[model samples]
Target: MTAASPRIPSPLLLGVGLMLVAFNLRPALTTVGPLLAAIRMGTGLGTTGAAVLTMLPVLFLGIASVLGPRVSRWIGPDRGILLASAVVAAGLSLRALGGLVPLFAGACVAALGIGLAGVLIPGLVKREFPGQAGLMTGLYTMTLCLGAAAGAGLTVPLQDLFGGSWALALAAWALPAVLGTLAWAPFARPSRAPVAARSEVTRPVVWRSPLAWQVTGFMGLQSSLAYIMFGWVPLILHDRGLSAVDAGFVAALMSVGQAPAALLVPTFAARLRDQRGAALAIIGLTLATYLLVVFGPLWLVVPATLGHGFGLGGCFGLGLTIIVLRVRDAAGAAALSAMAQGVGYTIASLGPLGFGLAHEIGGGWVLPSTLFCALSLGAAAFSLGAGRNRQV
Candidate 1:
């Protein structure tokens, strides 16, 4: 007689735990930008130093993602996720302490947790929710968008609540991570031995696959554009005469739009035989965002931000979905996921810094917008190859 399938966690518990993990992935880094001005003033860090603090976590995210498989190997995937959640909590808590050194250290630590978790989650979805990859990806991505919006919108209010202390505001974000870790605890045991044994025998040669590279390129390019928006879009609006408050609002609104788009895009993408139409849709929307940033009217900024966020969210969701679609099984999914994010994020880390230099040298937003439009086109080209209905 066939052995019974190993018991999986309840669908409700699994999704909740997954989304909670998703929720913490972005807050650690995204929250810092809003408080950068205050942080600079409080710590007496120069512009260059502040820039490093902002960029450091992203750098580590890309670099540390290569460690995901190894970490999972040490502890099974379930326990690995638990460990990542704990790391995120520890990192966020460390940042709560008052000092420049702790602040930088905390960001790196948190990003390391986010990056490793990032690599593992796609594989987890593939293994645990195999039939609903698209739906699950969409849900997790929606939570990610909401979490980012919450962080951006709430941090200042939280700072005010704590008597204008940015440190306290930054520290407050750690609470959700702690909650996520606890929520995940019940399902955090090591993967069953039979599943682990099967995974070891079925590893995919992802590094040598051209389709895998295309997926990785798509992931990298889209992320590059997203990080640029995260770092500069609000500042661009502020420079164009919007108040700091209004600029932040527009940025947060952009993030809010990402949720619905992320919620819907992957579902549609999964139904299509190939994702070219979906990818072209992304290109079209992203192009509109750049145009609005360059020349849209003040009254239109809100809608423009909404459209921008929507396109970004869709692109991001599609990128994750494609990683799953292209691979054949959990082993391939894990390898491709880790490879794409490890190298993809490293490539993405250049976007904000390079765009900043370009803006400074060109003395305006015009040239930078032009460059990103060109990069968006490149992403579309890569997506064409990646979106093909073929397995890696």
Candidate 2:
């Protein structure tokens, strides 16, 4: 008798699990920005220290992403994600204990979890929703942005609710991670029979491919912009004369704007013959809106923030979509996902750190703004190659 195929969960269950897991990915990073001032006051952290704290999650994200494929191969993606969620929950809890050591340690642990999920989820989407890659990627990216928005917007209120304890506010995000772990548990049950593996010869070595490098460059550059928003935009707004609450709300608005664009951009881009125009348009919008937020009339800030969010969200979604588009098979997607996110996020970690240093050294936002514009141009250049209609 032929061996029975392993049972699979219903599509609805799988989709819900995937999104819930995605929701756990960003709060660990976003919550820190709005709470940075309070945390620094409590912990005696200076601007440089704050920048290092902000950069830690992103730096570890790259490190853990490099290990994702190997971990998935050993434990299976579902189980790996389950473990990641649990780690995130634990890290967030640790971060709430109120000290510099715990804070940095927790951030690193949480980032590692986020990174593993980041690398594994794309391959899972490509494997499970092959025909609906664009739609699913859009949905996935939208959920991710919503998570970020929630963290950015709710954190200050949460601090108030906790009677001005930033630690408690930061700790509140752990609940989602715990919930995600439980929600994904059923799907993470090990298979009854061992699965067979494909030959190594068929897997593409994406590290050597120029097309893969182009995609990685786009992912990194665009992500640098996204992380800058996540890490510094609230503080930037505060410096422009907004209250902490107002600054956080504006940052959250930017993240909220990302939702619709994240949902639409990839779906639209996937339908086009080449995504180069879409890529260039997104970069242009990003640059213009960001400049307006920083230097244009104060009255224009809200609309400009929204436009910035939309552009960055589209840029991020397109970056993820390009990973799927550039490869032909699920295995190829997994391999390329690992390479792009691994090296790409490593490159991305520099942006927030550089921005912070520039702000401190120059005593203004102008230097940082220049750096941001330069990164946008670099991303635009790489997008030209990454958005081409060719598979690696």
lDDT of each: 0.82, 0.89
Per-residue lDDT, model 1, residue 92, is 87
Candidate 2: which pairs clash?
none
lDDT of 1 by residue, 1-392 (tens): 98875577898889999899889887887677677667878889765565466567777788767898888788877888888888998898887687898889998998899888888898888888899999999999999999888777677778889898787788888999999989888888767663535653233567878888899999988988887787677668877897656676777887898999888999889888999789988878987876886588877888988899999899999999999899877767888888889989888877776676677668788877877887798899999899999987
Query: Which runs in model 2 stand beyond 4 Å of their true positions?
Result: 1-3, 189-204
lDDT of 2 by residue, 92-135 (tens): 99877878888899999999999888887887787679999999
Q: Kindly report which residue stretches of model 1 are placed more than 4 angstroms away from their true locations once superposed.
A: 1-7, 44-47, 194-204
Report the CA-based lDDT of candidate 1 relative to the real structure.
0.82
TM match of model 1 to true structure:
0.93
